[model samples]
Target: MLAIDGSFLDFKQLDLLALRQTPVHRLDPRAKVLTTLCFIICVVSFDRYQISAMLPFLIYPAVLMAVGDLPFGYIMRKIVIVIPFALMIGLFNPIFDRQVLMQIGSLDIWGGWISCISILIRAILTASAAIILVAITGFPAICEALEKLKMPQTFAVQLLFLYRYIFVLTDEGVRTARARQLRTFGKRGLGIRHFGSLVGHLLLRTWERAERIHMAMLARGFAGEIHSTRRQSHFGRTELLFMGGWISLFILLRLYNAPQLLGGLFTGTMP
Candidate 1:
């Protein structure tokens, strides 16, 4: 019963944070990763005062979040944690660039603030998209995606192996600690010397396991690369149409007049 309960708990937690099985997840990891990179590049390429231009770019991330069924609040919270880093770098702009680029009656709007806001928006969009991508795609898919993208075969394979064995290693460490606890009884747990010894033992065990796995792989002809038999994924017409329509619309708004369009929409000229 205890074992069953533990397994159930682990399964539930994994579902809460683990990757979902959906169309987005089934997409070729390499392609999805590349598209995400392109999206971020497009967003960052816009100059300051590009709020309207950024709107259409928002569609890509939004559709991914919605269709992917990702945990939006969890991803947004991660974004909030990283906001302080951006704020630290951008806060200097207001002090350094004192010249006002625009004015509205008594309020002097500095170019620094505009640039800072631009930086903040780009940072948020890029980070949020990245977190969502990883959350929806899982670590193995990411490693596989990297592998398929012509990344160094050795490096990508190492990541794949590392992720696969991490949990096993962790479980071994936990069991060892429990055994130590049972033996120590009233003794101080995890003292410096004891901790050092435990770490050394864990390292030796991990090395031995790796060696055994390598030998097993050699026996089966690893051939210096890991191979997966999963079918390749491709984007359909719907995805292409969505990407094209949004890219063209955003570029048009950016080149023409973004702020005017936004103002007109707010003022009821266009929805």
Candidate 2:
């Protein structure tokens, strides 16, 4: 029960963070969304063996987190949770491709190893950017931004509903688990046989609760779109600068390997 509650709180921390009054949080959501999309594209566009080139993209998320007043440790923890999935994606790289790509001192690194490490770096960069985006902009605003950017209304509404009901589903599951625990002490109701029944009950309860909520919303005159109490923001000059600056930086990083150029300059290796 405690674990369920703790996980729920942790999951909702991004929404809590989004309520802050920082400059990053105040930018038009469209700007942040587009900038983040550009960042992800640049980071993932690198060749499979390119690692150092992608390191420069980390600055984007770092700046956002600092300016947005987001908790670094909390965001890092969230990113760590997704790292295992990234690892799984790249796990077989080294086994399939064994050609040597680089040599450092006595050790030779294979192309597959480099590609695998590149995937890990890409995962960290992209994941951090995404989490920071949600922490500052919130999911609702993001969905709204998508709608404004010409996404289908149905698709955006579906995304918004999916995000909103995740909490509802989680709450239902937590309550069901607690009730089961109270009814059966220790390992009595914890068997695999009881698991299916618990899930069935939770699903039925959630379905009923959803129906009631839907009826209430309909009665309240909820249209196809959900509206926010917050004042609507426009795409102003500040948003333009914010989006343009980051996109320009991303383009620069994509075209030139900043780290390699700096190393060359320091070592007098530039022609």
Model 1, 64-84: lDDT tens digits are 888887767756766786799
Model 2 per-residue lDDT tens digits across residues 1-271 = 8966786779888899999999999999999999999999999899899999999888998899899988889999889888999999999999998999889998989898989999999999999999999999999999889988999878987898789888888887888888888888766775888989988887888789878988998999988667656458789999999999999999999999999999999998973
By TM-score, the best candidate is 2
Question: What's each prediction's TM-score?
Answer: 0.65, 0.88
Error of 2 at 23 (Å): 1.5
Q: Candidate 2: deviation at residue 178, Å?
A: 4.9
After superposing candidate 2, which stretches have Cα over 4 Å from the reference?
Answer: 1-4, 177-200, 223-230
Q: How displaced is residue 5 in candidate 1, in Å?
A: 23
Q: After superposition, which runs of candidate 1 have C-alpha atoms over 4 Å from their true positions?
A: 1-18, 48-52, 158-223, 235-239, 253-259, 262-271
Which candidate wins on lDDT? Answer: 2
Candidates' RMSD to native: 6.7, 2.6
Give Cα distance to truth, residue 199, candidate 2, Å: 3.8
Indicate the worst ten consecutive residues by lDDT in candidate 1.
Answer: 7-16
lDDT measured at residue 114 in model 2 versus the true structure, 0 to 100: 89
